[model samples]
Structures are given as structure tokens and as C-alpha cells.
Target: MGTDVNRKAKHILIVGGGYVGLYTALRLQRRLSRELRDGSVRITLATPESYMTYQPFLPEAAAGNLSPRHVVAPLRRVLPKVRIINGKITKVNHAAKTATFQPADGPRRDIAYDIIVMAAGSISRTLPIPGLTDIGIGFRTVGEAIGLRNRVLHQLDVAESVDDPDLRRRALTFVVVGAGFAGVEALAELEDMSRDSIRYYRNLSPRDLRWVLVEATDRVLPEVGPEMGRWTLEQLRERGIDVRLNTRLESCVGGKVVLSDGDVFEADTLVWTAGVRANPIIESSDLPIDERGRIKTTTWLTVAGVRDAFAAGDIAGVPDATNPGRFCAPNAQHAVRQAKVLADNIVRTLRGEELVGYRHRYVGSVAGLGLHKGVANVYGIKLRGFPAWFMHRTYHLSRMPTFNRKVRVVVDWTLALLFKRETISLGEIHHPRDEFRAAVATGRKH
Candidate 1:
């Protein structure tokens, strides 16, 4: 009877191995001493990738300041005690305490869990625009970031080799939709890289390149206050970047961008980093969610109307304790902090201890505007240029997961200081199957 009961260990299954999932599991694995040793509790983490991407480093990665591998932490290495299942949870039945998981190449399977942590994160929230599918690329994943870097460099090469004015003009132009941190940082980094790489090509110069940032809002970097936003706009404009404020992308058909403000332009590259929506998997779950499709949670981060079900990070609509009638903004700072509190509360629930509410005030924002230039607003004190740039790097370096990853990223930065940033475009990395397809065709012909 004792063995039978022990065999039925309470399984804590966490979906999405992003910020919340990794941090929560790290805490639980360290805290679940007696429960784990006696087989009374077990933790499992399910995610599409075996690694977690440190999204803040994406801009730096694209600029080749940090290697792509250093920005991602492998789940297996980080969460050794927890069962790392490489899959995605398609649906959740909280009433039954079971979830349906689909592996990369395997059939669907039902996983029973005593506790569920919904941290599936968010996906790029895009609008319905013509040719968006064909011409636009998102800046959410590491693959996308690296691909964008290669594509930008390849366009430089294309412009240098081509004689046609139309082709050269299209190849040299780059359009970025959105003025958020991701969009702005990506644009700045890529543009800086292109500027540095201009001397390598005889036909391509800084004048031949056109980088445009389109934002529907009147100001950019709204997280950094209106004053700072305007300062950033002026800085970008001074750097010859076209900052289109209060503008929206009407269409992007065949490398032609039609703006809502009666402007039309041709560009070969269109990067979309407008916004993100909560993972759609939350809707399929039998849990209380807000109108925005995020799991409705109390201040303590427990799922409302559901027992043993909790959520944090982007997927959880956690009430803002500091401000009533509002929810916490979905950002990395809140996500990482909430994961810690949520883990403690989960342990408290198991021990029948009191739970504490989660509350955090907005602590301002920081952004990098190309190399050695940035903007920051922390505790109402504003900073710009190299000081903000150093703060941006220092802050993210400290937040990056694992000592090993930190060392690797620092090494990449150190090497960059000693050597110039590599500008070669390895475009074939994305099309790994092309060689196989060509080989198959030749074999059939023979």
C-alpha cells in the first residue's frame, strides 16, 4: 500500500520552458527536498525547444555582439532533476487534471498532473496585411534573429552585384514595423552593422542604405516616458534613420511597403515586431481566463476558479497589486519576478502555509540604440548615449541564465572588442534541406 501510494506521486507539469517555467522549476527542484526524495512529488517541463531563449539578447545576437548559442540555456542542463519533455501541450482539461501533449515527431499523449503551471508565453500578434506572409519576418525567436542578420548582409551583397537600379534600390532598403524595444533595438543594431560593413563592398555605402522605423504611436519607446521617447526619435533621426511616428503599415506586397500616411516605398526586408498575444493553448484549457485570453489569476498568482493550477509570465493575467483595476504588463522583469513568487506560493500551498500577494511597481525602461548609444529612464532619472548603453548591457548580462552562459556571452563580447564584427551572410543555414532536395532530383533523373 505504501509503495502503491508512492508510485502515484504528485506530478507538477509546467508548460513552456521560457522565463517562468525555467525559474519555477529551478526553485521547485531546490525546494522540494523531502517530497522529491520520497517520490511524493515529481516535476516535468514540456516545451517545443529543449532550450530557453534570453530574448533581450536577441538584438545583440543579431549584431554579432553575442553568439546565438550563448543566448539560449538548454533545459536538460539547467533543470537536471526535472523531466524535460521536448513537446508542446495542445489542450488542458483542468477539471480532469490532464493535458494533451504533442511531441515533435510522436503521437499525441495525455499527461496527468496534480499541479499545472501555464507559462506557454506569447506569439507574434500580427495584423491582416497583404503579402505579410511572403515579405515580412518576425523577430521573436533566435532563428529569426540570426536569419534577419544573414538576410540583411545578403541584401548588401545583392546590391553590390546587381546593375539594375530597381533591384539595387530594393535590395538596399529595409523596413521595420513597430517602435517597441524589440523593433527599435533590432533596427538600430542591424543598421549599425550594415554601416560598419559598408566599406567592405565597393558599390554599397551608408548613402545607398535606407532604414525606416514605422510606429502607429506618436512617440517611440513609450515605456521610457514621452520625454525620453522624443529624445530617442531625435537621436534616430540624427543617425539618418527615418522615424515615421503615428504611422501604420497598410500593406507589404512584393517588397513594396504602403504606409497609412499616404507613403509608399520599396524594400526587400520587412521586419515585424509589432506585439505579442498570449499563447493560443490557454484558450483550449478549462480555466478562467480574462477577456484578453490570458489566464485570470489572483494577486498571489494562483489560477482563479481552479485548484492546483497556477500561471505566470505572459500567459497569466495577474492583477497589479500596486494599481487596482489593472494587470501587470507582460515583460521580462515581471515574468522573472513573478516566477519566484509563484514558486514560493506553490510550496506554501503544499505545506499549508500562508500565501503572499505579488506586487511590483514599474521600474522604468532601458534600450540600446546601436553600439555605444542607448536611452534609459529608471526611477525618473533619464540617461542617454553611452551611459544608457552600458546600463543596457550590464543589466541584461546579470539577468542572463547560468554562470556558463554568462561567461560565454562575455567571451563573445571580449573577442568582439579585439576583432571586428563578422559581416558574412550564411543564408544557407535556414535552408538545410535544399541540398537533399537537389540530390534527390538528380538521382531521379539518372
Candidate 2:
């Protein structure tokens, strides 16, 4: 039976709490009319995390320039009216109007809804390289950022105390496999942090650390134009970063990284930021998907031939109205803008109004290569050095979700300028139970 217009309230179910899901709900919550707001609609958002991570700041977070907690918007705190479920939606039974979800601590359960928003964003795209799973870490979430920082600092501690040459070398070497914004920013920021941190350790010096970046394609920072890309390469190389162009990481077996360029080396840390694919959950859903496994949506951000279903962000292939033949790029700018359109369209659909198409022109790209260094090209205006770096900070700071978060991020930057970057690594945070387990085992042996 259809949603009873007279008695039952319409339920809006959002599958993921990332950029699209969170923003769409926020818009809808604010724009809904007084009558509908009272009790006509119920918005339920189900996500793996209770917070939405501002991913662009992950590099700075890793370098301890910003607090990891401040980089995420807690859904419960931000969206008080929306029902937030700390669970993952495993499958969507659209035909039956039911969705199955498994909570972190409970068995699978199903919920019925009148509308479904498929905003289940992307996951790390990994290759089947040997030992990759055992050694590699991704740079997608706040947890990964924190863990990487801890591991990097911990490795320095190990290198300082270890006397074995091979062990020391392995501990000192750091490899990042990707050259996009995520990879480049992460490498630069972490390198800067590590260099500054080395002064505290008398045994370690700047020269002792080796930072390597491997990209499968010809150049790094492809989002930025060629000129800025070249400038980024030169800047990174000048700072002692090994930028391996046209190179691929074949295998990372036993901590030894085998590259396509015939180079093999042992490294203690391997960060995989190569790329991302749509969330695998979409594949199982009965939706029309593109070749890359993204849900096929019209320019208006609605799933083609599906009623009361909408999608956007990295998971949906919405054709770009501005660029006739192509789809919108999977980036924060597009995701945020498309969410606005998607939200408005949802409202329009409810009001029986015409939906508008999603259209956005390619703005520009920017990358920060450590502190006081960056590259950018905004509306054909090229820039590099500290100017670009300032632009990077300015743009992201303004676009950060909430005003509170924006203020906090500014406070972080201001404090960073006044004080020094924090260098302490809480590696044990990830394995808090390990030491307790070890002690229990020791007592049993005794």
C-alpha cells in the first residue's frame, strides 16, 4: 500500500551519513513547511559512523594541526530532529520498501520507509597486491588519519632506539601510493610534521627520513592543470621527496615494496590513497548502475525510472548539465552543490513541483605542499607558493560544514601559528585492550 496520506507519516530513509546524506537531510529539515515539520514526515539516517568527516582536512589532522574530533560533525548533535542510527544498511529492498541494517552490536533488522536516498559514498579502491592488506593503511577517515600519525611517530621512536641498520632504514622509510590531492597533501603535511618533530629526538635528523610517492599515471595532482602540476613536482622534489612518476607499486610483500620501475625496498609504513570506488553495498541493490558501479541518476539527481528515490555524491553517476556528455566529478564541491539541488528537488517532489537539473562548472583545484607552500588555478588564474597555500586554507575553512566547526578550524590554525604542532602519538589508543590481554595471559602462565 502507498504511504497513507491521511494517517501515517512519510518516512525518508538516508542510507549513508556522508556528505550527500547529511547535507540533504540538513536542507530538508530546514526547508520543510510548518505543517509538514510538525509530524507529516520522519527523516531517518543510518550510517556506520555517528559523525560526518570533513575529509579535506585529514592531512592537517594527521600532522596534528587540527583536532581529529573537530574535523567530524556528530550527527546527533548536528541533526537533533533526524533519527540517527549507528548502523550500516546492508541491503535495500526497494520493491518491498524495506531496508536491512546490522548494528555494531546487534543482529540484522529491517526498516520500512516511503523514500530512500542512496548516498552510500565510496570506499578505498585497492589492488590485489601481496601483503598489501597486512602492511597498507588508507587515508579516508579520521581514524585512519589518527592511526597513521601514531604509527609514523612510533616508527621514529623505534628507529631511534634500534641499532640494526636494516631495521633502522625500514623504520625511517615512508611510502605513499597516490598523487591526487589526498596523497600529495598527506605526504607533504606528514613530512613537514615529521621534520619538525625530529628536532625533539637527538638521534634522528631530517636527512635520515625518506619520503616516497608513487603514482601509476604520468604526473601528480592531475586535478590541477599541467603547469601547476609541474610546479608541485618541482617543489616536492626540492624538499627531498622522491616523486616517482609513471610508476606503479606491484607488490608490498613482507614490508618490501616492489615497484613497476624495477625498484624494491623495505619500508615500515605504506599508505594507500591511490583511489576509491563506490560503496559495495550499491552493487547488491536493485538499482540501475553504471559500468563503474555507481547508481545511474538523471541530471535532476533522481534514480532513473525509480519513484521517490534520489542519489548524489561519489556513489551516483548524475550527468552534468553543464558538460553535456560527462558526469560530475566525485569531489567535495560537486557533492555539496549537488546535495543542495537534490534536497530542493526532494521538497519539490513532495509539493508536486517540477525538479531542476544539477549543473556546475569546473571551478579550479588547489593543493598544499607542506606549510607556507602550495599550488592552485582558480578560474584560469594560476598561483603558487604561499598565496596558493593561503587560498587552500581560506576556501576549505569557509566550506567546512558548520559555523562551529569553521570557528574551531580557524582556532586550530591560529593556535598552530602561535604555538608549535603537537608531535605526541597515541599509538596505544588503537590497541587499548592489547596490554590488558597480555597481562591476563602472563598471570595465567604464572
Candidate 3:
């Protein structure tokens, strides 16, 4: 079967630029190349950013082991045939076959499409903890990762410059809430970076810095199973990291962190990797969503009972065909694979052929704990320390979008082995306009 040549042109609108959007569109570009060239099928990808961030590398990016730029692939470059819109689809009116497109700047407009792919991925799931909005930072984006790195290094500088004991103590303490893959890896990597940086500081030592990991649950890396999780917990504790399990962050009003265990301390830096929720933008769409606000999707990766509409990744509650009574876990592993099936299914739909369902066995999990440290349980085989770390890097490097980024990341890693990791803080980049504003104020005063 093939696409009907007599039918009208079809437009495929893809929402979000994460794994699902990028991979699906890339596949469609190849699968429907003839249609795209003939103007019979059009693909438009609308996302907040022009680049798709490879989130797994975010921890290494924060640790200065990978360049921030290398952690993302430009959407335009990757999908040359697909029209890339550096904006967001604010609302989806599937009944009307139109979506509200809100650009990074300027007025909103409605776009018409024959089919829509809901890939508007998840966002940092924050809590109502006091002062969290004022003080805490998430580890989701490249900006946040790099900003946390600068904040950590800047805290070191603050400790070195200050003579007050109380202030120094606060400056040296770093707290991370959540011991999941993101939380643990981020804490471990930054701690390793800070420890390496201590040798360059005159008044600082590794002992002076306090690193804490607080998880509401009793274990870490739950996806890797209890055995590997317990092993990982032991490894972290052995590195002098304060792993506080069964603890919730009661409050962080001011820099004072109050834990559920009745422990209170002042920390200058607080990193929140607690969790992520589906992008609330999904609420505006007229689609069937699950209890968690994720769009309901079938095993074929199509929106449940909604023809010509698809969803995958964190935004979709796609049922696991391999595992009954459960949905696929929201991870890169599943997202990447689902995209392939999703793209193939779309082509099948276009050709008036039977669509295929997505089904894959759980391959296990892998997570990095700073340089030369990691844990992995792929295909029921367990590995720890350098082997795990090597596997983590190798697996992620291969999965990273585009060969250019993969080579750049490898070069960054290669350079790290030959030289020391750069610990310089560029916090000023966060407030670049501050210097200009100060100059204007000075001129007014003069």
C-alpha cells in the first residue's frame, strides 16, 4: 500500500523538540521524502527552543566534563526538510484541526494541520516548600546545569573570601533534594568537581565542603532494582556524601534547610532534581489525558481513540505492551524507541496500511556518579565503578543526536583526562545586563 496520490496534501504538526519530536520528524523526513518534496506532505515542528537537549548529559555538563553546547542538537540542522518554529503550541484544538502557536516573542497565531504529534515534554516538578521559588534551582535544562555549576564554584569563592565562621559554613554546604538518577548524578558530579577544585584554593579543603542528598524514599535509582540501588547508596555514602533517606524537605525558608528528620542547616546552594511533571500546556489541548495530565496513547503511539494525532515521551501515558497493567517509563530509552515506531506508524497511516504497535522489553538502567564512577544493570548484567561509568558514557554518546555532538563530547572527555576540569565560574552571564544597568545608573548620578 502507498499514500493516495489523488488525496489532498497532508500537514503533520509536531509539538515539542525533545527526543520524540526530533526522532519522529527525522524519520518522517526520510520515510516521506517524496511527499515532502512533492508538497503532498508537510512537517512542522514547534518548540520553545530551536535545540533539543540530551538531558542525560546534563549532569556531566554541570560537572564541566561536557560542554553545554554539545549537550543539545539544533532542530533546524537536524530536520532540514521540516519547518522548525522556535516557539510553542499553546493550545491544541484537534476538533477544529488547528493549534495556537505562541512564538518566543510577538503575537500568537493559529496553525492548521491534518495531524498533530503531542511531544510537549515534561518540566521540573517543584513543590510548595517555603523559599523554594526564591532559592532553589532545577537540573532539567542546560542553562540550569551550567548555572548550578557556577553557583557551586561561586560558593567556593565566597567561602574563601569570607572570614565569618557561620557565613563560611553556609557557603560550603550544598544540598540536593531527590536521589533519583538526576538528583544523585548531579550531586555526585558537582561534589567531584568541587573536590577537584579544592586543590586550587588556598583556604579550602575537601573536608570543609558538605554535600547532602535527601530522598523522600529509602532508596536511590529505583529503576535499577533494589540490589543495584542499595549498592549505589553505599558507594555514595562511602564518598562522604550525606545521603538522607526517608527524609522530606520541610522548608528551605531563607537558606535554612529544615528537613523532616528535624535537621536544620544553612546551605548556600540548593539543587532540586526531585521530579518532573508533564508540561501543563497539555491541559489546553482537547485530547484525552490520563489522571497525571499526560495524553493517553495506545501501543501504536497514537493518541487513544483520536485518529491522526500521536503522542510519546513524558507527555504521553503510553501503555507498555510488554508489561501488562503498566505504562512505559518516562525515560530516554523508551522515548527514543517509541519515536521510531511512532514515525513508522504515521507512514503506515498515510499509506492506508495496518499500523504496528510498539513493544520492547525493559533493558535495565545506567547512571553516572561523577568521573570514573557509575552503576549499570543492562540486560540483567550489573556493573559498577569505572566499567559502569564507561558504559554510561559510551551508551549516552552513541545515543546523542548527530555525529557532530558525539565527536565534540568525546573530545571534551578526552581533554579532561589530559588536563584538569575547568572550575571557573561565569555567574555574571546570568545577569549580563546588570553591568550595563549599573553604568546607566552611574551616568545619571554624575
Cα lDDT tens digits, model 3, 294-405, are: 9999999999989899999999998999989999999999999999999999999989999999998889999999999999999999999999999999999999999999
Candidate 1 clash pair list: none
Q: Point out the worst 10-residue segment of candidate 3 by lDDT.
A: 1-10
Give candidates' CA RMSD values in order: 2.6, 2.3, 3.4
Residue 253 displacement (Å), model 2: 1.0
Enumerate clash totals for all models, in the order shown. 0, 0, 0
TM, every model: 0.97, 0.97, 0.97
- Runs of candidate 1 with Cα error greater than 4 angstroms are 1-7, 439-446
Ten-residue segment with the worst summed lDDT in candidate 2?
Answer: 1-10
Inter-residue clash pairs, candidate 2: none
lDDT of each: 0.91, 0.90, 0.92
Model 3 spans with C-alpha error above 4 angstroms: 1-8
TM-score result, candidate 3: 0.97
Task: Record all residue pairs in model 3 with backbone atoms less than 3 Å apart, i.e. clashing.
Answer: none
